[model samples]
Structures are given as structure tokens and as C-alpha cells.
Target: MFAALPAGASGSFGLHPQDGPHVDVRIAITDDQVTLSLTMNLVFLDELIPQRREQADLIDPPESSQTIAALLEYFASEQPLLVDGEIVEPRIEALYIDDPSPELMPLFPRTGMRGLRKIRFELIYPLSSPPDRVQFTWNSYPMSELTGGPLVIKAELTAEGILDIVEFTEQERGYTWHRTGQDIQSRMLQVPEPVVQQEDSSLLSTISIIVMAVGAIVLIAMLVSGRPAEALATLILMVILVPLFYLVGRPGNTPPTKEEARTIFDSLHANVYRSFDYVDESDIYDALSLSVDDELLEQMYATIFRGLIMQEEGGAVSRVTRLTPLNFDLENVGMLSRPTGPGLPEREALGFNVLYTWQVEGTVTHWGHSHSRTNNYTARYGVIATEQGWRISQMQPLEQDRVDDDPEFTLDEDIEL
Candidate 1:
């Protein structure tokens, strides 16, 4: 979606009002509830706001909160959604405006799609079961009431753990999904009528955005697994962003392939380090449970990461570990036991052995001063495939060693890394 705003309208704080009209809808559904996210290009909103402001008095300026709030109100009322044949009110969880340049630039089909303003909104609705049918209208207010007869729109919907994806124009509004006996069916309700619109131009743009979003969510996983090379490659492609957690890493779905198993493990492992690295001990157990069962969850907590968190003697202590090294030697890190053979099928478990060597600098009370130490670890992890993807079901240390090279410092305490 390419659009350009008039001169002096890009706002000092990075708001770019563009000329194109695009709406991106992302929907995630579970057994009990549905979460939807909408991203609307501000070009159409810029045109529609004047009509609304003239009709009412709330809208003051293009980038003001009042204008956004007013627009959100109209969007909520006009949003067409149904749950079990009844109209459902989606509760607004967040509403805001952003500059899409930083995100859209890295996307392919850049198509000079820069300097555009985006209105991002999230809505959550409770549902007893998955809706059998959907009546989705992209932008009713702009299409019905704006100065333009019908603005161009690009709508995208992704249902979590479901293979069906909906990406079409405003004309294709109705959709259906149902399951009978053992089969599930999903299809658009009617054939879309042809319109004089721009050809679908954002295929690469959509893919790039999804990849960027997924990378942002799971980058930490790659980091904790001693895979900084992979994480760094992704970081160079685009600025790191934290999208809504629900969009990526379908946590409840099984990983049918080895690559997926590795991805899930990376997410789980990185989250474990994040909890400990940030000193949030309470979250370690929950993070570990993503890849492991209860038995291993309790075991790792009691035997490994928890043991490291309790090493402080007294007084104030500070530790800093630098993860991003410019000249990192990837060969130093090794995977000892990878679960990549027929054994995994018979045992229903995957195992991994990863070796890491790193350094830390900090001050401890017993030392009464500052010191540096080099740490080395050879760790093995095991995960079992379950109904809800793969989980870490086992953890054990294959080897552990550390080196303190300061002659003045006596290293007597056990360190956790």
C-alpha cells in the first residue's frame, strides 16, 4: 500500500499522512474467545475525519487523541461481526496511531510505501465456540460516508492454528467456517465482484511484515539458545519490534516438523533466560513449562536456574553480561545431542545438547569488590511431543566449568550462568 502525504503533514513526532487507503485485519481465535487487530491507513481516515468533524465537534486535528478516539468509536459501531447468529460487541483493548515507515520499509513490495500513517486498534470478544460464519466489512464509514465512493482496501485475516487464511478486498465480505463429524470446511461465502482497483501489490509486504513480527517475538529464544548469529541476522533486516504475543508462536499447536520443534524450543529456552536474565525468578517455571512437562519443570527449577539465582552472599551485587559480540566465534558453541533421528519417533521425545562459553563481570559481597569470570557450560535438554506442541520434559548438565583469571581475586563461590 503506497501513499504519500502532503508537505508539512508528517508531524514532528513521526506521523505521516499518506494518500493510499489500506486496511489490514488480523484475527486470532481460540475455543472460547476471539482477538482481532485492525491497521487502517490514515489517508482514508484523513478524508473521512473532516466529514465526521463537520457532523460533530469532537475532532480537533488529524493526529490528536480526540480525533483517534472519535474515529475508533465510529469504527466500533460500524464493525460487522457475528457470533452464533448474534451481533457481538468487541471490547477495545488498545487504540493508537503510529508511523509505518520503520516497519514497512524492510518489507518487500516497498512500492515506495513510506511516509504513511497507521491507526492500530485491538478488540477482544468472548465466544462460547468458534463462529460458524462471519460477516466482515472492511471499512464501512469510509466506504459509505466518505467523499470518495469506495476506497480501496486490503483485508487479511489469520486464524490461530487453523490452516484457512482470508485475504481479499472489501467486496468479498462474507466468510464461513464449520466442522461436521471429522471434517472441517472453510470458504468465502460469495464470489467477489470485479472493481477498478489497484492490483494486489502487497504480497511481499504482507510476508515481510509477518516474518518481522514473528522474528521480533522469538528473537529472545534464539539468543538464549546461544544462536545470536541467527538473531543478529534478523535484527539487521529490521528494527526489533514486540508485537502482540498471541499472533506468533501458536503455543497450543503441535510441531509437525523438526524445524518447528526447534523454533518452539528456542522460544521456551529464550524465555527461561529472559526470566532469569531480568531477575524475574517467578516466571522461570512458567517459561520452562512451554517445552517440558510438570516433572521436568519442577526438576529444572529446583536443580538448575533456581540454584543460580540464590548465589548472592550479602550487600549490593551487580552483574552485567554482554550478549552481542561483534567478533563472535560461532564454532565455540556446539550442539552435543540433537534429537534428529528415528529414536525420536519411538520414544516420543527429542533431546538436545548445547555448549556455551561466555564471560561475566560483577561485584559480590564476599569479594568486597568487582571481578570478572569466564563461564563454560555443557547442558542437555529433552522435550516430549504432546497434544499441545512440544514441551521441555527433561534437563541435565553434561558438564560445567568456570575460570576466574584475576590473581588478586580468590574464586570460592559457585557461579550460575
Candidate 2:
């Protein structure tokens, strides 16, 4: 596709001859650029002969024969007349320059009249560039008295040297081979083998640089990923970030019957996760925002969080993980969890798994901690509706800190295990 064609352009090479001469010029406009042709007829003329007449013998008896002969001899010694000029020439007519634009004629010193004896001309066009139309007119005068024949002329012009444009590179050459202005996959340029060979070592250096860059990116990703909440908080701290997120987040949930379960899920992903493990305070709220009750949901959220964190006796090293889900399909809601990080011995024969699903009956906790006590977490949560939205509420935990005090209670409904 060509870029865009300009409106109402003259592409035909043409000539509109005037009485004195004929001027024909051809030009075209493509993609707002100009192209010109080789042949340009700028001037013209005509030649003719008249019938001879004999002088009467008694016209007063022309000048003496010797006198006339002497006069002709005298004229012969002088310059020979071609009759092209005013000697045998008729009155000079008018002059014209074809198309005129850019005010060039007024400003250019060479743009002016060319007068020779009987004719006068107006140079309407000066030194104009492409996009300017060229035009000219011939003089209509026919004077037979002075010269026996009319004038005839031939002229030519060149355009190649006038345009001096560059040759497009291979990649850019698509501008020619393909339709311009259309959406298409950009073609890749082929590099010469000689150039490739010259850059072989440099290519290795570039690859090394790229590898290092990717490594740094991954390291940064890991560092930031480990603290999803902190990253979110920092982003929210920006002047416009929170508003931008809110705009993106709020649009889908326009209530007059807002269904936002998917939105709830998106929010969680946007605000939670330090990776596969660990929950930060912002993640806690991200989950809390899904709560349906103002009071009960707030209570549940506060319970899972505490300024006074559980401290290991003797500052012992133990892992702590707390999580709250924001979006879940109750039908697909089931839990399968296992120890995944440090302190779970790599070669330890015993591993831990747990099933906390509501879908199927007979599902049971897989294993318990070595201690006799275990925790049943059902009392800690319920679903409710509030002015803000649906939320998890009324979580009742048996204890806050120790694995030892939690009860090994089972569901009383007893459909199965």
C-alpha cells in the first residue's frame, strides 16, 4: 500500500500550446512526494517562404545598374543576415512560464521578461520546486513583412540529476516491494556474511551482557516477589498508582447489581503473594476486603493478624504461615497442603499433607503433628453479606499461639470420616 495519495493531482505529462510555442511537461505525485519525466518541450517555431515579385522597368528607372551592384557588393562584405533576429524578424510577441507557485517569480532575480525587437514575454514562474505545476504559452503574432519565413525551435530538460533521492536499504525497501500504510509484519533485514563474521566475537559479548541482564531481572523479581505486600504498599504510596488501580478495579463492579467474584480474585493476585508461601499485612486486607460483614469480618481479619507476633521460646527457629483467600469457587473449594520449605527435612521419611475440602465426604486430615493435640479450624469462619460486599466472618480459633493446646476435635455432623 502506498502511503497516501494527494488529492486531485496531475499525473499525465501534457502540453497546452499557445500561439507562439508549445510546452509539454510531465510530473506525478506519490505519497506526497514528487516524480518528473525526461522529455519536456519548452519552445516551438515555424518556417515558410513567400512568392517572388518582379519590379517594373520604369519605376523612375531603378537606381543605376552600377550603383545597385556596388550597394549589393557592400552588403556582401558586411555580416550575412540569418533573418532570425529583428533584421527580417516580425514584432516580438509575448513570453510565458508554465505553472507558477511559492512566490518564486517575485523573489527571483532571473524571473523576468525576455524581449527581442518585436516580442515581449512574462516569466510567470521562477525557480520553483516539485509540487509546483509548470506551464507556458506561445506568442500568436504572424508577421510576414519582415522575414519570409517564421521561426522554428526545439528544446529539452533533465529530471534525474534534479531529484537526487537516496536508495532505500533492504529493510526499508519494503516501502517499495509491499503496499505501504498497511499493517504487516515487519520484514527482517539480512546481514551480509562478511559483517556477521566480523561481529562474531562481539555477538558473544552481547550474549553475555543479555544473560547478565536477565539474571539481574530474575534476582530482582525474586526479591520483590518475596514481599508482595511491601511492593503493593510502595506502589500505593505513589501519587497516581492507587488511583489508577482503583479506576481499573472499580469499573467492573458498578452496582445496580454488581457481580464481582472474578474481580475479587484479580484483586487478590494483584495484592497478595510473596511467592508460594508467606502472607503480608496488605495481603491480609486484600483478603479482608472480600469480607461481607463490617463487624464480624473485621474481627476475623484482626484475629489472623497481631502486632504481638508469636515468638519462639528461646528465639527458636520455626516457620509461620498465615493465609486468607479472596476469591474461591465454593464448589471447587478444597485444600491440599504440604510442608514446602525449610525445617522440613529434605530426606525426612515422613512428610505432611492435609485435606480441607467440603466437596466430598470421607475426606480427613492426613497427618497430625507429633504432639497429641490438633486444631479443627471450622469455627473460625463463616460467610456473610454487608454493605461493602460478601466476606468471611466470625472466625473462632481455639487458641492463638501454640500447636500443643489445639484440640483434636472432629466434625460432629459425621457424614463420613
Candidate 3:
């Protein structure tokens, strides 16, 4: 169902199957620790609940010590919290069982059928100050399959609006958040495999090394066989090969040019929309840093993540398509000197503008229903040279016009599951 809302506990389940239980996780981060709140479906827990008979047994905990430990272990391993690259172990703090309200039951499928139980858990993990990068994996059922089907997970961060809400299905299972500002800077994560393979190739050096070894063996063989003429010719070839190999092996540094700046802006612009299209908030922030400065990164985060929170609440998801940059300009600002490193002199600063007209398709959905509209977006971007190359310093949205009226979708109260 196309429901609109931050994959919050309620709206998240509306998108998944009602016959099964889903897991909802909320994470809140403080300076020193991360708090995780997990809500599990009671219907789903039916299998895990131990059979009982006595009145005292009913008063006893519904879950056994082993069951609790196993669940905790599953949770800990499924979505490991990594500060930098180190995994942090979390301590379980609290657990409780409750029932969803009648009004809220409509937001979740099958909750009222056999009655629903909400199992809540609180866990805390220590963290470093200003972590380098925070990473998590989302796999609801990593160990064993349950009766209904695969588990659906909805995740959110209540760290004072620091993180965007996240949803995970069986298909998408990982999320990464990069640190920015407050002396916290992050380079792009390792280049994607395809991109890395395409750029800064190392094939030439490999070939050169192989040839050098072969040439040495050939020269030695010729000399041992009393073929001085061939050995001498081989020696000449080796000397010539030395300079050729050195030149080929030298790393090439392409200075930032206006054309390159434009390309960077276009890529960054496309990436921003692509992240939203895929419902990847972490990627949005990471890609933002590639072209935009920290201030603009934060602004974009607020606009893209915070603004969409309420919409997500209704179980609505947005997917962008066909983002076209119609026009752009890369203007050069005067060169300004900045220190490169210790004892190094300042170098010229490259500055520019990346202005363009963008056309895009926006698809939003709620409760299995969808609405799509075409939008024409015009904006100007300010790009400046940094140690990392050209990055966007500012972003100004000039205008946004809906190219078409949204398609209508009627939601029947008795919509089929």
C-alpha cells in the first residue's frame, strides 16, 4: 500500500504484509552513547512465546531467558552499529509489552485480527565523540524464517533531528551516515567498484612490470647461449623500456578545470535526486558533501529529510525519475591562496557557479495507491575549490513548477491486502 509517512513504527507496517509481524527500530544518539528502541509484533512473537498453564506462569515473563538472549543476539548481529569501523556492543536496558490503540490499528495490517502486542526494548551502546562514520545493516530475520514471511523493518533516529527516518525491506539491507562539520569531515566512501575500474587505470603498470621481468629473463638467456649480439640488442631495448615504463607508471593529476567543475556539479545534482528516488537518506548526505559545502549539506538535509517526515508518516514514498539539467554555467572566481599543508605555500583557489534548469518526475504513494507529477526545477549552485576539489558552496532554488497535475488515486476503506 502506498502510505505516506516517515517509516515510523505505525506507517511502516502499513506498507508490508498484515498477516505477519514486523520489527520497528528507533535509534537516538547522544554524545557518548546510542539508544535503540525496538518494537516487535506480538502476533509474530506467538511462536517465540513459551506455552504456559498455571496462573503464576501467566504472571511470569512471557519470554524465557534463552529466548531473550537469542533475540538480543539476533538484533545485535543483524544491524551492527559501527563507529568508524569498530562495532559497538549494546547493553539491554529495558523491555515491556503493550497493545496498540484501536485508532492506530488501522495503520497496521492484522493488528486487530488476533489482537496485537507491542514488545518494546531499550538498548544502549557507547560511542566515540563525533564518530567518523556511523553504519548499520538492516536484516529483520537473519537467523530463522518465521510463519508469516520475511520480517519488515522500519527505522528512525530521534537524535534531535539529526537523522532521517529509514525503512528496510528484504531487498534493501544497509545504511551509512557520514559525519560532517564540527571538525568532523569525511571523504567519500571507497569509490564504487564500477567507477573505480573505469578511472585512474593501473593496467599500464601491470603490463610494464610483466614486460620488464620477461625482458630480463630473455637477456640472461641470450648472454648464457653466447649470443652477445642478441644480448646487447636486448640490453638496448631494456634501457629504452626503462624511460617508457617510468613515464607510463607516473600518476597523472588532472587539475580542476571549468569543464570538470560543471561535470562535478551535474553529477552531484543527479546524485541528490537519485538518493531520494531510492529512499536513501544516508546516500543523500554523502553525495551532498561531494559537491556542496557543510552548511549547504545541512540545509539540504533539513529540506530533503526533515521536510519529508510528515509525508512519510502517511506511508508515502517518493521516487524521482528523469532529472534533466537543461542549462548550466561554470563561472570562475579570482584565485585565492590557501595553505596546502605544513610548510607548504598557498595555492590559487578555483571558484565557480553551476546554474541549471532541472526537469524531474516525482512519484509519491500511500496505502498501495500512487500519485505522479512532473516538475520543472530551476536552480543556481555556487561551487568553490577545496582541498578535495570543487564543492558547492551554496544552492538557490529559483523556481519549481508542476508540469502536470497529480494523477488521482482513490483509497477504498476495504482495500485488498
Candidate 4:
């Protein structure tokens, strides 16, 4: 049986805003090859290859070799990959269209229910050795007037032990990855460093002005009353006492109280988890930099991100929803030295160590369902006062235990109780 395009569709096919087609692209780089996989709705495929609109049966549809050839040709011209500043051609690995899972069928547009399906294309680009840099440009976003606006493409990249997601829009369609000293540097958004306000000095200056004015008036009145010796003594005393009062009122670097330490740690700990809210690797790093020292930024990011992954659940990254402090103990306060390069002198900074116990509620959503897990963690953190305010300089995890786990199926928005 042959499937035909929906009837009554004019110059362009329109879908409800909520039911518009979604595209996902995954790029995996290995030692010898880079594999790219793209998946989208059949509506997008039909728009790209109009001839496919008349194909027989979307499930394992019989397509002529010429059609496949045309698809490959189109990608070769539109989607290009440059490795080490040279363009590399990709070889077609697989091309097919199939019905989506029953659970996801309702998410498709109702207007094209009979003919729409899911289509996937996998391509491989060979490399002589591991690439130092790779650039991928996407120019295939559908520009049909049927689309409410430019489509959004979510791209997941896995290269050099790093995993990140980036959204490609019509305005920005290119991505570049650079290998930097055993680390991969993808597109990272720069976050401005927070400004630290200094202590107010106006109060001390005000007191000095008041003392001088009062002393000047007394000296003038004493001279007019013929008490010159007494006035001279008073003038000398004012010069000495004014400086003494100013020195007494100046603020000093006093160690934070236990209560203050607790408040500071709470904010730093929450910020660490909050960094994961961003999907972009660079954004995560940027957010973390606000609360983490530069020397520990990369290490902390990897450790926390790895801890959030649910290995039993197919390596899905869990989203942190809530954090509750269970117990906090200020361990020690002393001068800590910031790590510096060899031959550079270490700078001493005020720092404290705390043993903290906290509970985290995390959720992982996949296939229209949510799995929540609550875990308790105990760790010792080292926080130091820097030019950027207090930052986490070190961390040592002592214990971790899963407290609760629950799986719940999310109801489709279209379904009513």
C-alpha cells in the first residue's frame, strides 16, 4: 500500500506550533573516524526531497538508488566538515525511514498522522589520525514558510572525553572544536567576573573632619580670651588625638564567625550544583568559575558532572532540583596559600575548612517519563577569600548514599484527566 501526502495542503504544509518537527544531531569522534547521526520527522525529509512525498509506505519504504544518491549529494554540498583547515568528504553509512515509538506518536502533528514518520541518516567521515581541530557547518535548516520561524537543531557532541549539547539556530550554524593541552575547547561563553565591593571608609573621614572643626573653634576662642599657652597645648593634643581616633575606627581583617562561615558555605555549595543547570559545557564552566577557583574549575566540573550521571539508567545526566543542608561543622580557619606556577611565590589568603552533609534531589527525564533520585552526601570543602570574594579551593568527598528512588510516567499534555 502506498502512502500519499496529506490532501488540501497548498504551497506549503503547516503544522501546529507545538507539533512542529524536531531535529537532533549527534556527532561522535574517535581516533580514526567521526560519525554523524541526524534524526528528524518525515515532514522535514519530504520538504528536503519532495519526490519522497509519493513514496510507498514510510515503514521500510522502497526508495530508488537515484533518490539516495540525490540525498547524499545534497548533504555533500550543504553540510561540510573541515578538519585541520581542510574539507573532508563524508561517506554515507545508512539512510532509512521508520515509524516512531507508539509512545511518541501522539507528539507528532495530527494534520499529517497518516503519512508522517521518522527519518534518520548516519554518515562517517574518515581521518588519518586524531584531529587537532574540527569544524562543522550546518546549512540544511528548512526555510519553508510553513515553519512558524527558523527551526532549532539540538546537537550533541562527544569528543576527547567531553560531552556537550549546543543549539544551532538560523543565525548561528557553525561549531568549532579545538584541542588545547589534552583538553578540548569548544565554544565557551565568557562570563564576567563578579566585582567585590570594598569596606566603607567615609565614617572615619567624617570623624576626622568633625574633630578638626571643633578644635579650630576652641583654639580661636582661647586666643581671643588671652589664654594663648592653653590654646597651643590644645592644638598639639588635637593633632595627636585626631590621628589616634582615625586609626581606631579603621576596619581590620577579622576572621569570619562560625555563623558567617556557615552562610558562605551554603551559597558556594548551592552554586556548585547550580552550574550544571546549563547544557553548554562552556556555560557550565563559566557558571562554576564564579564559585570555584581557576585551579580547581576543570576538575570540579568533571567530578560533579560524572556524579550526576545515572549509570544504570543508560548514562543519563540527572538534573538537580533541590538541595537541603543536613549538617555543617566548621573544621578549621587559617591562612591558605593559593597555588601558583613554579618559581612564583605563594600568596597567603584567609581560608576555612568545613565538613558538610547535604541531600540532593535529582530527576532524569527520558521517553516521556521522569525518574527521581534523592542522595545524601558528606564532604569537606576548603573555601578561601580571593579578589573575587570567597571561592571553593578544594573538596574531598567522604561518603555518598542514595536515599530514595522513584519512577513516574509523565502524562502527555494533550491527555486530560
Candidate 5:
């Protein structure tokens, strides 16, 4: 008995079963069409179309046409592709069954597996012009009885020279691709400028000097005229005026509290990672200027950009998705010397050195695949108050370790559609 899975079908099981059925969805968009391909193992195919289970010849079955028709009908009804907010039907381009590769054999093991063949469907949805937006909703999931859990679909999309990956589950079944000339997941951190307290002592100093000079002349004249009482009164007035001027002329430069320092450093550190979101070097540098010192901006950008590149993925840049500060210690706080202006003498300001440990979750998508990694890093950062605000002055990496690495494939690299 062959029955098509209902729309938005999902399993009631808790977790995904190990070595269970999986689906790979690849989507590529060109000027006039959107190409979509789905690949699944034989067990999953049999679960979808039961007639395949009874077939003697899996590769060149006599009922291959019927099986393909059933698949096409099922997808046409269950999976709806939207282009520019309009529902578009996908026409089947090709369907075939091939032997599973040695590397993929582990994914679909021989033990308890119905067959070693893998089924693939290449489909195309026509577009009048380049679409501004495209969305796909996956509604078919393997039954709990067949896979013991809900299906996991690794979906990869390539459009406008940008590649992105989205994992689709029962909970997250829809993926939308936009033609905007920007990384969808990338964003700049909004770090507020540092507040600086301004001080001007020239007025008070001038007033004090005038008062002192007048008092000195009066006292000297009074003493010269042998008027000691008047001279003593003048001296007392001068003493009071000088102290008042000194108190008023001093600037109130209070250092940040420990909690405040943590907040400041947190924003600065996060902005450093967010700076890579921009595509242009000048844009990245502009973003970095918000949190990093000008002296360290270029060097920091180079170092961090190099670190973000995944060499295994052919030098693909990873986008940071999440950042978590595990441990933050305000090691010390002291004066930071900075140049007042060009050709001006350097002055000291409030600064702090911090030792912190954090973890970054980054994703690298390349060639229709997505690789995710979580890295734990411990580093020392020097944050100082500047005219712009508080900025990261120095960064010294202490330790870095890759905590997790997960690579997901939407299609086999060797298999060309």
C-alpha cells in the first residue's frame, strides 16, 4: 500500500534517531530559474513510496516511472515553493537511483537497511526574472514508526554569489532566501560612544593669578607702610581664593566600577567580532573604529579575519552567530597614556586590563555545505577611555580551543546534478 505523507507531517518521537534517514535539500537560483534537488537514502525512499520495497531490481526497476510520478505528485502537493510571494510549482527535471558511496555507507548502514541505493530528485521552478525573494516550506517528514524520530533535512541555498545553509526540522520547516546584497545573518553591534568629561582650567587659572598678584601687591604695600593688620587680612583672603580656584579647576575623572568595566569590555569585545560582518574593507574598518583603537584597528582586522577563515573549506570566512562570555576577570585598572591630538603631548586616562574567557559559535557555508564550530578562547584585553569613548587598546590571545565542529551536507560533492 502506497500512501503519500500529508502536508506538514511530523513525528511525535522525541529525538532524532542515530543513523536514521536524512534528507539533503539543495537550492540554486539563477537569472531565470530556481533549481532544487533532494537526495535521500533507499530506506527513506521506501518509507515514502512503499512500492519500492517490493521491487526486485532497485536500480532499473520496471515501475520506476510510476515511483517517480508518485514522488512528483507528493512533492507538488506537500512542498510549496514561493517566488516573490507567489506559490510556484516545481517541475521534475530528473530522478534516479544510485549506489551509496563508501563514505555515505555509514549514514545508511547495510544492517537493517532495505537497500544500499540512494534516490535523488532534481527539480526546477521557473522565474520570469531574477526573484527578489524565494521561500520553500518542507512539509514531509518521515513517520515515527519508520525512522523512530522526526526527519532532519540539511538545506543549502546558493544565490547571487552567496551561499547559506539552514537546518530544517518539524519545528523549523520554512526557509526564505533574499536577494539583498548583504549577508543575512551578519549584523553590526551598536556600541555607544564613550562619554568624556571635559575640563577647562584657563579661566580659573587666569582669575587666580590676577587675584594673587593684586593681593601680593596690596600686602607688600601694606607691609611697607607698616600696616601689619591689613597685610595679614590680605594674606588670608589670598589663601582662601587660591584653594577655591584649585578645587574648581580639577576635573572629575572617576574610573569605572568593576561591573561597569565588564559591561564596557563586553560591548567592545562583541563589536570586534561583529566588525567582520561588512564586506568592504573600509566598512569593516569603520565598524572596528567604534570599539577598537585606531592604532590597533588594521592589525586587529587582519588577525581576526585570518582567524575566521576556514582553511578546510577553501578559505571560506565564517560568520559569528553567538558569543558567550564564560569568565570575566577585571585584572587591573590604572592610567592609560594616549595622545591628546596630532603633534600634541600624550596624556594619561583611565584604563583597565581584563582577562576573560569566551566561546564563539560560527558557521561557514561553502560549496552547498555548512560547517559549524564552537571555539573557546581565553585572552587579555586592554580597554581604555578615549575621546571617542572606551575602546579596546590591546588584545593578547592566551588560549584557544575548538570545542565542537559539525559539518552538514546538502549534497555529495562528487555527485553532480
Candidate 6:
């Protein structure tokens, strides 16, 4: 079913705002207590399901739109008894046992609910749809995605289930893509690059970012693994960004026909001997351990790539922009010090770089065949920088936090992409 948009607007791609007015809410009789299990799957305007291989890569982080906590609180306030209206809240348990279809799931689920982001339902009553005027709500309706974040909406749903979700703005424009069951599920599973993601830049930038990020995280892991001098020295130089980390881009956007996935990442192809006047062979080897091809090291062709892999001691250099590296100011440099990024300032004194980790919680949608859906991932990144000029040392500590992916009442179709 398509949501209706105004005369000419597009927030999502095509599904109008008026379609899917309330949310796919499902109530079940799992036990005596009411169980809430899923929430709306929010995506980008260009990100509705049935995505092909040419679609754009999902950018920014999942929490990039808004905090998951706020979305939950808003759902709790809409329970039937909590508001005054005549429209009846469907007794999901009765509906599930009596009949079942795609229309019965809650876009927003409440089980294992984070109390910090939820409001308690103090009572149970009946709520009428739009025409009767949803008593205490102003969120007339909710569309699936948001640009920058989400746009404010102005809509009204009638008890008959017809809705008009419009943007409450002068330049109103948004769209919604709609579908059901297996069609959407199959399309989604086939989409998205098979590789797990790491934050930073684009395709050319990705390879560099991953290598640097992992290396940095490893240093911290190394410190924990008992390499104090290397960690300490690495941390000091990186804090100052003597060397910088690098950023690349993403690979293909959607799924391809029969094929092997091919991805290209960026790197530092600088001639290191031109920047610093010090040449220490052992130090350079330790930093570029990953890039080293031992058999090729005996040859002379890998000098430029080898020398740039350092924060400690390497061939001296005469130029700065040899290869634009990712900024490694773990402290407060380069104007990119976000709380969600890693950095350290106290230990830059001894020329060592330190790795910091940014903890993030967000949602992701995998194009699941026959059923497009969304799940949450808790991720942490390791960032490192040096003191010489703030070059990035590595990006390690790459791990996804494990959390339960179910709400008490989820019926398998409420999650959005």
C-alpha cells in the first residue's frame, strides 16, 4: 500500500506520506503481559527496498539520523489507554490467533525496551484514527526516511485508515516506497556490498581508513598486549598528526547478478624521505608491518610506499602533500574532534601516539529476501594520532557490540529499510 504525498513532493522515493499512516502494529498472546517487539525501519530518500546494484551506499552512521531513544519515547505515548479517543487499539493477541496478515505488526516495538528511552503505559483505553482527531498527538503520521535527519510532518489519519502525511514546511517534498511480504524481503537481501563497513570516507579512502584505523586500534591492543614503548611513542606523534590517516570511498551500492565482489581502497603513496630528515629502518618496519611484502622488500621498488609507513623514524622528506593522509589529531586538531571519534592529549609529550575508541549504537537494514528488515549494531572504532604532525597511526579495536534484536511482539514484518 502506498502512502500519499502532497501534489508534488518526495521525502522518500515514491511511497506517499499518507500511506502506512500509523505503523504496522502487531499485538500477540505470547504470555499474560503485553509484548512489544519492533520499531519502524528508517532509511534515506533514495534507500527504499528492492534496491538494485547501482543504488547508493548507505552513508553516515545509523544513529546519523537521530538517537534511537527519542524514537521509542514517542511510540510509548501513543498507546490506546494513554490517550483519549474512540478508535479501538486492536487487541493483537486476538487478531494473531484469529487471523494474520502484513497489516498487524507495530512499526515500533517495545520489548526489552530501554527504560531510558521509553515511557511507561499507565493505563489502557481506545484510540480513534485521524478523522476523530487523535486526542493528544501532533505527529499526524510517520514516513520511513529522513534527509540530514528527518523532516517535521503534518498529517491526519482517519479511522478508516486513510492518511495524508505531509511535511510541515514551506518547501514540502518527500516520497515513500511501499510493498509487502516476500517481494521486498528478497530484494533487500540481494542489495548492499557484502563487506562489513568501517567509518571515514569513500572508496579510495576506505582502504586507507581501514588500514590506519585497524593499525591504530591494534597499537592500543598492543599496549594492552604489552608493547609499552611502541604504543607510547606511537601515541605521542599521532596526537600531533605528524603523519595523517587516509580516507577512501565505498564500493558498489546494491546487489549484482552472478559475480564476485570487487572493492578498491585508497592509500598513502608518498615518498617519506622528503618530509623528515631522519632515517630509521627498524622503526619504519614496525609501523608498516601490514604493507610489507618481505620478498619484495629485498628489491628497491617498494621504497616510497615503505618509507611513508611511519610516525617513529623513516627516511627524511622535503614535501608535505606527498599523499593526502587522514588527519591523526587525536587531541583537538583539524576541527574534526567529535565526541564519537577517538583522541587523547595527555601523552603527546613523549612522541608516542595513543589510540582512542568511539562507541556507537545505530540501526542497519539488510535487504532480506521476501522481507526487508532493520537491525541494530553497537560498534566501537579505534583511532590513533602522533605528536610530530598528527599523522594517523591506525584504526583498530573494530568490534560490533552484541544486543538482542527482538521486541516482545514483533511478527517479522514491521522493520523498515
lDDT of each: 0.44, 0.26, 0.55, 0.67, 0.68, 0.27
Cα lDDT over the full model 3 = 0.55
Query: Which residue pairs show backbone clashes in model 5?
Result: 194-389
* lDDT, residue 14, candidate 4: 21
Better of 2 and 4 by TM-score: 4
Candidate 5 lDDT by residue in tens digits, 364-412: 7432235677777888888888767788888888898877742431221
Tens digits of lDDT, candidate 4, 1-417:
222233333112222223544455778877798888865555565555656435432533455455567667766777778889988888777765554334434654452543335555677899998898988887656643345676656576777554555556778889888765342112222222323334457876787788999999999999999999999998999989988885766554456778888777777777788677666788778778878898889889988888798876667788776777878899998787776568988787777899988777777643112457888789888888887778889888899988774233221121000
- Per-residue CA lDDT of candidate 6, range 1-417, in tens? 112223222212211122121122222111122232222223321121223222122212343223223333343544332222343332221110011122322322321111001111111222332122223222323332323333344332111111122223324432221212222113221222233345444654565566668669967886998989888777775554423433223322222122221100111112122211112444444333322222222232253333223222122121122122221222321222212223533232111222222111122111110111222222122112222212223232323333234453223221121
TM-score of 1: 0.32
Ranking by lDDT: 5, 4, 3, 1, 6, 2
State residue 250's C-alpha deviation in candidate 2, in Å. Answer: 27
Cα misplacement distance, residue 336 of candidate 5 (Å): 3.7
Steric clash pairs (candidate 1): 291-391, 291-392, 292-391, 292-392
RMSD after Cα superposition, model 1: 28.8
> Lowest-scoring 10 consecutive residues by lDDT in candidate 5?
408-417
Q: Between 1 and 3, whose lDDT is larger? A: 3
Candidate 6 Cα misplacement greater than 4 A, ranges = 1-19, 22-357, 363-388, 404-417
The TM-scores, one per candidate, come to 0.32, 0.18, 0.42, 0.46, 0.55, 0.16
Pick by lDDT: which candidate is best?
A: 5
Q: Model 2 over residues 164-248: C-alpha lDDT tens digits?
A: 1122222332111112231111111111111011225465556556655655565567566796665555444443543454454
Q: Write the per-residue lDDT of candidate 3 for residues 1-417, one digit (tens) a residue.
A: 011122134333343334355555677766688787765555544433433423311112644354456656765776678878888987777665443344545644534532243455677888768565777776544222333545545465544234445556678777776654421123232211111112334776677788889999999999999999999999899889877877756653343556666566666665555444323466556666665566567776665553233343353444553555656666554443432456776455445565667566555433212346566667776655665655556677788666664344221121010
Q: What is candidate 1's local distance difference test score?
A: 0.44
Candidates by TM-score, descending order: 5, 4, 3, 1, 2, 6
In the order shown, what is each candidate's alpha-carbon RMSD?
28.8, 39.6, 18.0, 15.4, 11.8, 28.3
Better of 4 and 5 by lDDT: 5
